[model samples]
Target: MTIIDYFTQLGSNPYFGAGFGLFGVGAAAALARKGMQVGMILFRRHYMMTLEVPCRDKSYQWLLQWITQHARHTQHLSVETSFQQHETGRVKTSFDFIPSVGVHFFTYRGTWIRVERNREQHTLDLHMGVPWETVTLTALGRDKGIYFSLLEEARSLALEREEGKTVMYTAVGSEWRQFGHPRQRRPLGSVILDDGLGQRILADVRDFIANPKWYTDRGIPYRRGYLLHGPPGCGKSSFITALAGELQYSICVLNLSERGLSDDRLNHLMSLVPQQSIVLLEDIDAAFLSREDTAGVKAAYEGLSRVTFSGLLNMLDGVASAEARILFMTTNYLERQVLALPLSWASDPFEHCSYYVCLCDNFI
Candidate 1:
């Protein structure tokens, strides 16, 4: 029937308007019920089914690394580029995922899952259904499982690079903190030594690490010490860092002359040093003898360090001395007569010490 004719006929009856209103209501109700049904199915599957791992934790780091390796296959994702200074004083570029808030979807084991990074609180969250047994297996620490297999994929990504890089540090008030990366990637080869002292230093460190049990059996302290004496600008500091790099050990630089460094404070600093790392005391004599040291010591003389000739000795050895893998002390003094100003290091530590006197004729 034509719309005009049909509507005209319906308009003639009062029940026609009531029937149209009822039809509209029924359609709305059906759509609402369908929406609820879909929502209930999703709630049963994914609601409360999530795993969160913090960024600082080792497991999260491993997961991030895994994601970085598999990012190529992920269709929905984001990326960030970072520049870090390498050992040669050059900046190196690297790519990583931007751990920003948002959902990234991926397909794993024939199932779809989403990974999210919480912006406010740095964490990685995994969202998936019950059939996803890989996440459960990983959390349970099952070896050779699917999740662990993914972790192995990440570990194998960096086959050419070393696991850990050497870190450079500076004293921040009372604490030693990583300041920056060293410019000299070739720590062993960077230092310019006049004699074969450079080779000898490397050999000494190699032997020291190679024979740990030998020292233990002989009742030795299982520690080694080296004193590098030369003029300023002769690469004493550079050499220390290089030697540390060659041995794949970290370097902890200390400034004894730093203000507020008292005997107790020094001990505290020593106690916090990381194990199997090199401890460097640069310009031991200058710390006590420098004008800056004198002025600071004089102002806080009663409360702070006395800067005694033996004060350095007190910090160097004894129970408070840090259990370090190596202890390195450097100075510019060429003669013991000059070092005799305050600490009689010549008669005490130097006399009974295995030392290397790197006399640098040219400065780099």
Candidate 2:
């Protein structure tokens, strides 16, 4: 027998296969075994059982349920798996891993398997293997300032409940993925909004805290808009970046006109703004086409199609909003439109109030 045949024989030999598989499930050599019918494969202390069933989703589902129940003992450990796409539009499955769990929640790379997707139902299988805790948050602690800020915020949120207060917030996008969920808390940490000059910002910080709705409650504006306009090289962006650092809020950066966003995404984001933290719109004027009236209309109507004049009015001071949110907008326009003053922005009345303050070169 030649070398290739000899290696194949070694791999097929039950004694060798069982010994190697027992060493671990995720073992590279064991995973490569073709006619796998029995035994467990272990690699790097992580193990998974090999299973085969004619590429059927029902079989996959049954196996997935069994794995879930089997891995329940490992806390903070969840599965990651994927279906192997076959040539004839069919799918084959590999194996499920049993991962090690730790104090923080984690996800395995191969644990979540996409078995199939359709209109009616989306099926998946999670493998409990290769726990993410292998990489600890402690290693990333010193460097992850943004994440640490979020953790502090999480602590504050928890304490607020002790005082019997309801915590209301506005989150824009994926910020929650980092720090919102309890499982992800350790790695994601807290989101901190820093105004750079932390102590300096305290000048008006007390006012901001004492009355979050100071501007909104008075019917002055439902949204607090700030128009940062100045010649280039000024700290317009820096100032806002600093604010985000101090507030412990996750920032949502958007352009004046984003083509990829759909109407549903817009409404969904609007409806769920209170979950993440803040919405920051920079260079609002530069984001859209320079058709003054239309740009302003679209900038405000972003994510929706056919925004009527009346809808804009309601949005500026509408019946739907109740939370205290900071809607910050920036512009370097030749002539600024102050949100405080209704300047026929849309030539219509929106249900919500999007407040604004114009900063010209003089202020900068």
Candidate 2 global TM-score: 0.37
lDDT of 1 by residue, 273-323 (tens): 766678887766555553233554334323334444455555555545654
Q: Which ten residues in a row have the lowest lDDT in candidate 2?
A: 180-189
Query: What is the overall TM-score of model 1 with all chains considered together?
Result: 0.54
Q: Candidate 2, residues 1-364: lDDT per residue as tens digits?
A: 9999999999999999999887776576566664253332223123322222221222333333333444354443445554655447787665544332323222222242211111112332222221111212221112334334433454554444323212222222321122221110111112122332323333333344456456555644334434445545455555555555455445555543444443344444544554434555556444433324563353554443332323323443455532455555665552533442355442321211112243221110
- Which candidate number maximizes TM-score? 1
Error of 1 at 344 (Å): 10
Report how far off residue 332 is in candidate 1 (Å).
Answer: 4.9
CA shift of 330, model 1, Å: 3.4
lDDT (Cα atoms) of all candidates against the true structure: 0.57, 0.39
